[model samples]
Target: MHAIEKQKSPMQSLAESVLDAHTANFWLQKINPLWSVSQPLGKIIEIQSAATDTVSLKIKVNRHFLMGKAGQHHPVIVEIAGRRYERTYSLTQLDQYHVLLTVKRIAQGVVSQWLCNTAKVGDVLHFGQPYGDMTVTPEQQPALILLAAGSGITPMYSLLKALDYSNKISTQTITLMYWVKQHADAAFANYFESLAQQHANFKVHIFHTQEAPCDARLNKNHIDFIKDLSNSTVYACGPSGFVNTAEQLFTSAKNFKSEAFSLTPIISDEGGFINVTLTKSNKTIAIPKGQSILVGLEQQNIQPQHGCRMGICNKCSCNKVQGATKNLVNGVENTEPRNSLRICVNSAQTDLIIDI
Candidate 1:
């Protein structure tokens, strides 16, 4: 005999046909902003000043949200003036249902400015699944060097908290070198100092580069004070130039991992322009080679959806109909047709057609 299968009721069938999931969710959100059929949402619970130009928000996430690893980043979506804007920020999981997001206001950053100044307690925000590979593991070396610059300290703070929660801090030697423009710009300084005092194996150093008698930036000379580079695991997060310098200085470490929040696109020596055809928009534009497609498009008054322009988020990804492109970050070239390309990190090497 065949097994019986449950069938949908007439009302259920009618509802599914008449109202899509998005329409239903729109109604659901009217009752409770955090309520969603499938979208992950978070309600801001607490707000505090983190630094001179930074704010920390404690958010309570809904059941649909999936907590990411300590050092991963989550795409935050917010609506402003009926237009949705997305940005990626490193999240620190406070508990099973809560996470902390820190925002450093940028001069012209719409999302950051809104998050830091306009967002209020009880306001809800949407989130995408977390993505990143710079995570902590049990197999890592006992000696860990965490190097952070400016807003890059957020992920390092998360990593440290995770290590402390797992009771691993007491067994390992951890050193944190955090760089900021001034002492007032340093976030979580007290917390890190207290942790270092509580745990003898932990050490914290705050370097202010723009203060009186500035401390030199990351260079080979700084490595003289750090012990056992050959046996230590080095993790760095910062601007492209800072991360690049760290990589060069610590290349001899046992293991090196890094993530850059901002990147300066590498200009190719072969200076030329390639025509890029947008299939959906029915437009063709000439873009310079070796420059990111996103930048090129913006220069031509074409703005594609983008976030965290550093290649950490997939907001700028588009389907390539045909093209040869090079990844600016890793210098990998691709000529395969019908492939997904991230415009923010990839430059067109040849005339191309893309689904934008």
Candidate 2:
């Protein structure tokens, strides 16, 4: 006897007849908001204030959503006023079917403002697959140091929760040094303090940089308390300047990993202007050689697709038809044609043509 095959329903059969997934999804979504052939979707289940300008959103993910490792980031897409906008944010997994997304509202930031003020429970959100190499593992070093400044604390918090969930927090000596402008700006302060109270090997320190007697910014003095530099693994996340300082101070440690959420464009001394031609737009613009191509294009009112804006996510990457560009992050110069170019971190070093 032949094995029996399950029969498809009329809706399912009709959906399969659609020419494209998008067309099928357009109808499928009308039946069920989370129903989709490929796109991952989440429903906001809860919202709470994380800090003065920050909010923590608990999202219940659908079956298509792929869970990410601790310390990874997800590109969150939201639709506002008939326009779609995307931004990346660090996520903390709450359970098998849910995740926590904490967002700090940025001044003049469209998505941030909408998420912070307008979004409510039961609102649906779109998510890109999680990406980022920095992740927490079980076989980490005995001593761990976490350095975070401002919104960078999100990833560090996720890593810590992972360690705690895996029962590794009790065995390893972990120290978190977090910097914020004021006490009200610190997110998850009470949670960290409670966790430290329960674990003998864990310590949490919050530094208020703008208080009356301001705590000094990340410096060599901050690591003076750690006795085992050679056996310690250090992780730092923040603005470029803060991460750079952490790298300078902790390079001697056993392992040092850092990620900068924001980068200040590395202005080159080789001053001049270069012409960049947009192949698809049929427009030519003069851009400064020292500044990033993304910044230059934005100055000329050419808004390109971008996420993170720190060169980590490749959302801003485009095809360089022909150009001599220098990477601001690593200072590497590429003169090749028909190559992938990340405009957020690369500056035009000569007259160029790009597919934008």
Candidate 3:
């Protein structure tokens, strides 16, 4: 009869645990085995005008920086007015050591303003590894469907350009549906038109919500398009509520997928912090309201496996054995025993028991 003893990790200790600063550093160095792989740190090399307010930046990354997938996003860390800020932008085109990122100048966007107003051609920008799983695949099923809104077309542009560049245009049929408030608001509409001129497998459908004589109206025709897509493989990206109606439109459709790295929402959880126990690590900790549990844990020097900070990536998915959460946008509260929550977007409102 051998006796088994349980050892607690530093994050597991309720009270302050003894840890040497150097040991923590050493442990962090070995934490994610593949974290050492070189990632991009872009430097603005050139900027090209695409539209009135839209600018396409040609950034030069070192060769060691990993090139992103056709539809992946990379976090851009910038400093403005002595304050640090971060934003994610999808690559418009992937080139060797120079990926093109196009951004529309928002009226009051902090980082976008800085990049548009202050950052010079030679300014260095810290970039994270390419993240996001919403990518187009050549081997993917036929009749690919892409839906986007405003700047959401960033990822779609990458995928379309990649396919055309690789001469894989004949592999799959694609129907790209884009919507904008006005005709002037459309980005890369001319570009899509130019590509459609030569490519036979791609088609573009633009819906100008405010203008007359547009090809498609907003009401129910979009739903009809969703139904017509055969062997459907959906890839959508955009504002929070832009496409919420699709869940019902494609309830019966298969291979439905969406990607949104829109922004870090500031919705208040209102409720106070609650305690949570990470079962795998045997850790107990208090989680604050109005803040993502995953982020709060990271602030306390606790790192749960995370990829994209957005819930769409599912890298931060954790099993919820107890407690409740209100879906910020959908209002569909999630409270199932074996169900998983994307901790990146979910906040703790009550004491939770998690099987992390």
- Please give the TM-score that candidate 3 achieves against the real structure: 0.70
Which one is best on TM-score? Answer: 2
The lDDT of model 3 is 0.69
Candidate 2: residue 155 Cα off by (Å): 0.8
Q: Candidate 2, residue 202: CA error in Å?
A: 1.1
Model 1: worst 10 consecutive residues (lDDT sum): 1-10
Where is model 2 poorest over a 10-residue stretch in terms of lDDT?
1-10
User: Cα lDDT of all candidates, in order?
Assistant: 0.88, 0.87, 0.69
Give a tens-digit lDDT track for model 1, residues 97-154.
8899999999988899999989999999999888888888879999999999999999
Writing each residue's lDDT as its tens digit, candidate 2 over 1-356 gives 01223355578577968647888878888887877766889999999999999999999887778788898888999999999888888999888888899999989889999999999998999998888877766577899999999999999999988888888889899999999999999999998999899998898989999997899998999888677888999998888778878888888899887778766566667777899999989999999877889989999999998986777788899999997998765567999999999898788889999998
Q: Would you give me the overall lDDT of model 1?
A: 0.88
Q: Give the TM-score of candidate 2.
A: 0.87
Weakest lDDT window of 10 consecutive positions for candidate 3? 31-40
Clashes by residue pair, model 1: none
Reference-based TM-score, model 1: 0.85
Candidate 1: which stretches are off by over 4 Å?
1-19, 265-274, 278-282, 288-291, 301-307, 314-341, 348-356
**Candidate 3: where are CA atoms >4 Å away?**
1-39, 212-219, 226-228, 263-309, 313-322, 329-331, 336-344, 347-356
* Residue-level lDDT tens digits of model 3 in 28-137: 33652212123335678897776657788888765345667888887777878788676778875555657887888889687777776667787767676677778765
The best candidate in terms of lDDT: 1
